[model samples]
Target chain A: MPHLRWARALGASALLAVLLASAACGGGAQPSSGGNSSGLQVIKIATQSPLSGDESVQGIALKNGAALKLKQEYDQFKAMGFDLQLDPQDDKGDPNTGVANAQKLAADSQVLAVVGHLDSGVMIPSEAQYHAAQLPIVSPANTNPNVTSQYKYPEISRICGRDDVQGPVGAIFAKDQLGVKTVFVIDNITAYGTGVANAFKQKAQEIGLQVVGSQSIDKSETDYSNVLTQIQQVKPDLVYYGGLYQGFALMLNQAAVRGIHTKWMGPDGVFSNGLVATAKENAIGVYATSVAAPTNLTPGGQKFIQDYTAEYKENPDPYAIYGYDAMGVVLQGLKDAIQKNGGKLPTRAQVRDAIRAITDYQGALVKVGFDSIGDNIYAGYYVYQITSANASTTGDAKLMAQYNPKGELVSQ
Target chain B: MSSTLQTLPQLVLDGLVVGFVYALIAVGYTMVYGVLKLINFAHGDVFMVGAFVGTEVLRALTAGGRPLSPWALLLAAVVAAAAVTALLGAGIERVAYRPLRQAPTLILLVSAIGVSFLLEDLVRLVESIHLGKFVLPVPTVFATVYRIHVAGLQNPLTIRLNSIVVVVASILMMVGLTLFVGRTRPGKAMRAVAEDRTTAALQGIDVNAIIALTFLVGSGMGGAAGALFATQYTLVTPYMGFDIGIKAFTAAVVGGIGNIPGAFLGGILLGVLEQVGGGFIGTKFQNVVAFAILVLVLVLLPSGLLGERVQEGA
Candidate 1:
């Protein structure tokens, strides 16, 4: 009878311990329940980026800048009655993975908004899910106009100008600035490449320049000597390329070897300082179009640039500034929306609406303004010229000129 | 009319420069298969490891951004990369293949694929060390050009000093190796082992050492090829070696596996085909053109460019 009583007592105590542990762990409790302990509410913002892959260099830069901005705004957000935490996921710039990552973020309740899917190829597939799930997405680098305009419900937004605007600027420069009468347009045949090239060709024809030849190339194949030779035979005054830095650098070097001295131009995809670093002498006299001004010149962009250099010991690229701006807009939207909705945690729909209604949301890079389609209305473009004696050091190259949205050269 | 004449030679010249690099990488694939009778599928990953080694060596030597003379950096990178890669190659053989010495051909082939995956993941881990937007430094001397005027049309010409260096270095290495294998004490042992492992062991030769040496030499060449590849292409990435590895293997098989000179011949030929094909057709179909040529060569010459059959002791 004594042993039986001891066993019964042990069983009762073990069950009580489990119940106590469960309550302490905060399981089976609602966050919405009236709170007794009030300090700062930490909301999580997550995004998918190409952390490793072909575009990883740009993606990493974006990640670092976004992290810095999130850190800098934490105190400000806390004072505004909330706290911000950044969650980053690596999609490797793959569309399939990007979609899955979006779904994963959708399932997470704490995730208030997102700021990613850098590649337009990835963005096209992932945006619908984020929209359906009511997650606000702000792409830092994707410039494909259709990413926003073509979609009926766009949870996607950006701080950078569209390719539609930048492409025409490049074409106009080739036409009026360089006074090139004949042109040959080439693209790497990606959605971004083709879209930008089509815009450039249309504007070039409209600006009274003859499109004598056009060709398509793949990114994998390195040797462009034959294409350069053929393009040389066509004898165009300028060769316009629509591709990323990898193929662009190879083609430029091969073109120089083949004696195609025609001036080369490309969109933001090929505008990287890395392109000049790889192609060197071949990149001389080449012009490129970009959506963001040099980070050194923007209002809040300079501070981020300085901070990045101080931390990483290297100057930040243009994408870094845009990335910082994207984070700023998302966090700012969340804070203002939360304040407006009865000083309570607003729903994801309220956050999405807040992001779309963002007008003159001040950012380090630019004053971000989103249209109904989630396009940045205040975004502008610029043109850069690359001059390098060698294919390694990029700091030696000069940023020759900046162009506004209307293609007029901005006075220095 | 003069422009047209100038364009062909220019195209051909550019093609040869590009072709030479491919040939150098291809030789490693061909020579290893000659005696082993199996393709070292992980050869490309070996090349990639060599490149990373080169980058590290260059980074160490050029610490504090004190620019050493270009030639000094080049010499250090090439030697260090090759030595490191040779060591890695030998290590791979011991860890992966040596244990499976008596395994079937399919098993060995599967092991090679497994080794390739292992090396790639290892690279991905190492890649995280250099955080964010790392631009590799390349010397201008490699891609510098001297314009040549032909038929009153100024043709911009590039003289790849690196290509000349690659050719000379590969030649010297090959010559030294040929002499070592033909004249040295270990050379005979290696040859004897290649003939019949059972008989060579009976003759008191260490079969393991001979196999390790073969890997060391082949991997050394691969390392040299990788360093030159970076200088020639002016770009290096973790996965860059994979497609190139496939191309090199194709070259080796086309030229008769395990044959040194045959691999060289096959590599240059493959390069020429790629160039001519890309020129005639679009660059988009260059891979198709290279594989098509390989198929055609196999149809015509089943044993490969220089493969020979041997009869057992009469």
Candidate 2:
């Protein structure tokens, strides 16, 4: 009877502990009412990317670049009586995960703006949730025109050029500079891949380059020999792939095995030091196009790169500078919103409005200005050729050419 | 000659090369399932761990800036991966699965899944903590030595020295496993235990020891496969095990779940079918083709191509 009474008392205490824990969690979940008890106002800039999978290299670079910019401006914003923080979310490059991330960011009342959703396939679906929340999201590397063409979300924008521009630039380069008369195009069948491949195909044909054969491949399948075998028959002058680094590296390796030694070219998705590292010697002589030039080339971009390397102790990926620029745009907009409200933290709606009003803002890579549909007006594609397949250093890639908005290759 | 006919040899070779790797992993799945009747979902993560083991070994070996010969690197990788994963397999079986031996099959399966996720996340967390990054770049351990061109072929088929070594090593392992299971005392004990654990125990066979041995051999095979796969792909992530493990399981089921030869056949067949199918059909449907074969096999012949039909008591 005494033991039974002790057991009952223990159960009562356990129940009480559960109740207390639930109450604490409930209090924590509630939106913070402006300034915390410490009298410091806090706001979050959320970043969504494939931070935990095969594409995490690019995603982590983008996140770090954005975080670097926010950290640099932390004290400056503190001077105006506000603390800015970064809330990084991993979407795993999947649309469903992207939507979940968007909802999570939307539910967090402290998050004022977002800087990512790197893959266009992810951005397309997740944009609706962010739009419903009236949260402004700027993409650093999404290129599919469909992401912004419909203007479904006024708060959605991208600092990078669209596929319609980048793909055509690739086609023009293949036709004019490389003298590629016949080409074979392959897409990984994602929204970004198909969109860019189609754009490249159309431009190739219009510019008098014959597209001999076209195919779509599953991105998950590492063995590309069967497809490469089929490609051997076509024997096109150039092979253009619209996919990420993983698939492209495998295809290139398989193509080497099959003795199909055609010149290789790909869109901005394949533009990364990771690709060069992944492909090894196969990456040599391969051409990739990016919407922004490498940060080491331009003076302002070089300064940004120097700071980034000094901070992170490594070179930034091609998209990292774009992420930095995107964060710069958002931080500038936040400053404008704060100043407009007379040294008070602005509402999410005010920040969104300020982001849309940004124009001719000189960024690390290019001039940041949005068109009517939130597309960067000054965005253009730059071509890079892998001069060396050295993965140990990031300087293996050399900028070969640049294509303007008009799809003309220009002198660097 | 037609393009398809001309490329047939290369395609088949490519398929077989990958098929052999799958077959190696499949042996682990079949051997474990044969004795335990539980699908070791964590088997794939074991393979992933093996790959990391191999990577770490090679990284350390090459840290002096002087590279080891391809053969030396491959040997070191296989031995290191196999030894580490053998212990891990035994540990996993002891920690996660052994406690649930008397539980319902469903419970054991759930525990296995939990173990799988735990291993994956644990690897990620540990690797991230140590390296400050999750994605580990596998150094080029083996360089292509020669490109062999057969007579009457338009293109020279790439004959990577590493590929030949992988194929030979796999065959040797397969032969060794077949001999061990078919001839040795421990192999006979394993067979008896697989046939009936209670009867084997009554016959004075050490059931626990045999089960642990089965895990050791299966996991050793998986570890070797991981080392070879990392060398071929030159990129290893924590999640790499999931896809390959699923495919290897499918291969085991396709060949015959509890049959050793069946696992090998199923793996090679599935690999060939995927490559040939991807080549003939569009590559977009390659995965669909692989899984569709599984569904079709299950529907038509539930015992799989090489599986023996067993009777269940009503």
Which candidate number would show the highest TM-score if scored against the true structure? 2
The candidate maximizing lDDT is 2
Q: Residue-wise lDDT of candidate 2 within A147-183, one digit each (tens)?
A: 9886557789888888988888899888878889999
Query: Which candidate's DockQ is highest?
Result: 2
Please give, for residues B1-314, the per-residue lDDT of candidate 2 as tens digits.
37667777777887888899999999999999899888999999989998998998888888888567868888999999999999999988887777678888789889889878877877786676677666666777656656677897776676666778888999999999999999999999999998888999999998988999999999999998999888876667788888899999999999989899999999898888787767666677777877787789889989999899844312
Write down the DockQ of candidate 1: 0.24
Provide the interface RMSD of candidate 2 in angstroms, 1 decimal place: 4.1
Report how far off residue B85 is in candidate 2 (Å).
1.0
The TM-scores, one per candidate, come to: 0.83, 0.92
Clash pairs, model 2 backbone: none
Supply DockQ values for each candidate.
0.24, 0.39
- A1-412: candidate 1 lDDT, tens digit per residue: 7787678668857865875575344321222333424566767787677777667666776877777778777778767667567777778777889899889999988788988866787888887888889888888888887888778475778877778877888888777678789988888877778888889999999988999877778765555666777687788998889877778888887666555678888888876656766776677778888887766765577788778788667667557777788888888888778888977888888888888888898787788888778877777777777766443334344565666655566752
Question: What overall lDDT, based on C-alpha atoms, would model 2 receive against the true structure?
Answer: 0.84
Q: A-chain TM-score in candidate 2?
A: 0.90
Q: Show where candidate 2 strays beyond 4 Å.
A: A1-38, A257-259, A390-393, B65-67, B312-314
